[model samples]
Target: MKSAKSETLKGWALALPLLVVLLGFLLLPIVMITIVSFWQATEFSIIPAFSLENYEFLFGSSVTYKVFWATFRYALITWALTLLIGFTVAYYLAFHIRSSNVQTILFLVCTIPFLTSNIIRMISWIPFLGRNGIANQTLIGMGVINEPLEWLLYSDFSVILAFVHLYTLFMIVPIFNTMMRIDRSLIEAARDNGASGRQILTNVILPLSKPGIMIGTIFVLTLVMGDFITVRVMSGSQAANVGRLISNDISLLQYPSASATSVVLLVTVLLIIGTLMRFVNIRKEL
Candidate 1:
């Protein structure tokens, strides 16, 4: 009992720093935000009186619903694209590539683009997607269309494209790591049992890759949901998401409204993560 107690004390000693940090940085901010969310905001200043007006206005506005729906649209589309592309790349890297050295090199290649900041990568797309940009010029040169596609840039397409470009690696890395942990013998056994490639992929590989998929989903969703800069720049203000809504409120000095929106977003994300966590055994991955 003494040894157990001593070990427990030692573990608590090691973990205390992280616990303190979480309480100070994470929990404290959330508590403050929740409290401030009920405050009143005026033209120039915030009033600390308890008020539900912020939330009432937020829920009453049609724009709020539209913005949230748009945010979900962005997340859903990005998640689907990232999942399909990430899974394919991870599958190839995990199974098809025989050499471990080659896999490492290729995996490093996947991360090369991320070395630069997301803003740079997002801005880089503007050159390629602009009216007279390479995509339009190339298409025109190939007689695909005579006119430049004006909707290419500063639109949802550009926003989602930039999203996929920036975040696909997040999806790939986790899925690849998870796939690498899969036992090769199980795959061979499935093959020996006369399972086709499609069957094996659908049944053997995909079923085992759930933890990684869930992890990657969480990462992608969290990033996409909280992102304001990417949507603002890439969409050229043509789009409005919940993040941009919060940003706009903050810019207008509507602190209470911003806090309320933030609380809603936080709750929304937590609910999603909780739902996904139900199906995934994260311990297995750990």
Candidate 2:
């Protein structure tokens, strides 16, 4: 009885710090945001009165629909690309690489992009795609193009490319961690039983990695949906996203509208993550 009490105390002590932080930072803010989403400010003040006008404006406006659709479209495309590339890279690292050292080296290389600031990485694309950029210079020098391409920057393509570069690592790490935990003998047994490489991957590997894939998808989709800076910097004023719309509203002291937009985004992301979680045991499956 004494030992059980001591262990319970120890567990409580360990969890206390996390519980405090979660309550103070995450839960508290979320609760406040929920309250504010149904509020309207008077005379441009910090204090807001409770109302449904914000939500009414959000759901009733066609502009909100357009912005949300744009955000969703880009986010989905980015998520799909990240899943494909990240899984392929992680799969190779886990199964094909025989040496632990090589695997470590490759993993480090995968993380190199994350070492640099996202802004710097996105800015780097500007020079590469500029009229005097290396790409244009080489193309012109080789007579591949008569003139520099205007479509290189300030376009949806540029926004998607920047998003993929920034978020692919999020997908890779989870998938790789999950893949590493998979029993190697299972793959060997499948092969021994006359399963081809494609058969093994499609049947054994993918099914087992569903949890990781779902998690990575959720992360990428949510992050991309909320991002505004990358789209602004890379695509200039040509591309508009939900994040940009929120930023614009906030800039004009439209807190009620901004909070309403945030609520919608939050609910949408949660819905997606929740729906995915239902299909797999994210923790144990991984």
Candidate 3:
């Protein structure tokens, strides 16, 4: 009994720090948000009173639904593009490359974009994608079009383009890590059994890479869904999303409204992550 009690105490001691951090940071903030979400807010003052007005407003507004649809649309499109590009890159790195040194170097190359701040990298695209910018000038020089494409920047295309550029690394790294852990003998055996390259990839590699793909999907979806800056900057405020909605509410001194919107967004993101985790053993795969 004494030994077991001592071990239990030690375990608790180890876990205490994490428990403290989670309670102080994550749980406390959520509790505050939930509380504030029920409180009343005015233009000049936040009143300490309980009300469901914020939620009623949020749910009743057609604008809210449209913004959420835009959020989901961004998540889906970004997820698809990242998966396709990330999978291709990971496969080439894991299977095609013979030398581990070369693979490391190439992987490092992929991370070079990450060395700069995200804002700077995103802003850099403006010059490249703008009218009379590199892309437009190059296309014009090649006689692809007579005039500069206005939709190249400050549009949905730019938003998605920036998303793919920024988050592709997130998708690539996880998939590559998972792919690296796959057994070489399985691939060799599949080859020896007269399995085609596609057969080997589909049967052997893809099934094993699910954890990574799911993880990457989670990362990209969360980032894109919670992002207001990207949409605002890239779309020139023409596009609306849940994040921007919350931000607008906050800017207008509507604390209750922002909190309510934030709570809804939190629930939505949690549901998505929960659903994905239900099918995959992310901890085991990692």
Candidate 4:
């Protein structure tokens, strides 16, 4: 009993730094924001008083619902595309690639874009997808269409494309990590039993990769939900999202309202992450 108690104390000592950081940076801010969310906002400044006026205004506005809906739409689309592409890429790297060196090289290549600024990478797509950009010009030169595609840029398509480009790596890394840990003997045994590729994948690999999928889902969903810069730049400020709403509020010095909106977004994201946690204990998998 004494040894176990000592070990527990050691574990707590080891975790002390992380606990302090989390409490100082994360939990404190969250608590402050939650408190501010209920405060009253005046024309000139925020008043420190308890009230649901901010939330009342939020629920009363149709624009709030529209912004949230648009945010969810973008998140769902981006998550689906990233999951599909990431899974395919991870599967190839884990199973098809024989050499560890080559796999590492390829994985590093995949991460090369991340070394630069996300803003720069997002803006780079503008010239390629613009009205007279390379994409439209190529199509026109090939007689594919007489006019440039108006929907190619400054639309939902461009926003989703930018998201997929930026966030696919998040999905790939986790899924690949999970795949690498899977036992090769299980796969060989399944094959020896005359199980087809589809059967083996469905019955074995998919089940084992759930933790990675859940992690990836949580990452992509939270990212897309909270992102406004990509949507702002890619959509030419034409699109609306919850993040944009909060940003605009902050810009106008509506701290209380912005805090309320942020609180709502945080709660929504937490609910989603909690649901995902029910399916996979990420700690155990890791």
Tell me how far candidate 3 lies from the true structure as C-alpha RMSD in angstroms.
1.0
Q: Which ranges in model 4 have alpha carbons more than 4 Å from their true place?
A: 1-5
Q: Over the full model, what C-alpha lDDT does candidate 1 score relative to the true structure?
A: 0.95
Tell me model 3's lDDT, rounded to 2 decimals.
0.95
Q: Superposing every Cα of model 4 onto the true structure, what RMSD results? A: 1.2
Which model, 1 or 4, shows the larger lDDT?
4
Tens-digit per-residue lDDT, 1-286, candidate 3: 9999999999999999999999999999999999999999879799988899999999999999999999999999999999999999999999999999999999999999999999999999999999989999999999999999999999999999999999999999999999999999999999999999999989999999999999899999999999999999999899999999999989999988899999999999999999999999899877
Measured with C-alpha atoms, the lDDT of residue 84 in candidate 4 is: 98
- In candidate 2, list every pair of residues with a backbone clash: none
TM-score of 4: 0.97
Query: TM-score for model 3?
Result: 0.97
Clashing pairs in 3: none
Question: Which portions of model 3 show Cα errors greater than 4 Å?
Answer: none
Instruction: Determine which window of 10 residues in candidate 3 has minimal summed lDDT.
Output: 41-50
Candidate 1 lDDT, tens digit per residue, 1-286? 9999999999999999999999999999999999999999888998999889999999999999999999999999999999999999999999999999999999999999988988999999999999999999999999999999999999999999999999999999999998999999999999999999999999999989998899999999999999999999998888899999999999999989999999999999999999998888788654
What clash pairs does model 4 have?
Answer: none
Model 2 misplaced regions, further than 4 Å: 1-6
What is each predicted model's overall lDDT from 0 to 1? 0.95, 0.89, 0.95, 0.95
RMSD, each candidate, Å? 1.0, 1.6, 1.0, 1.2
Query: Between prediction 1 and prediction 4, which has the larger TM-score?
Result: 1
Where does model 1 exceed 4 Å of error? none
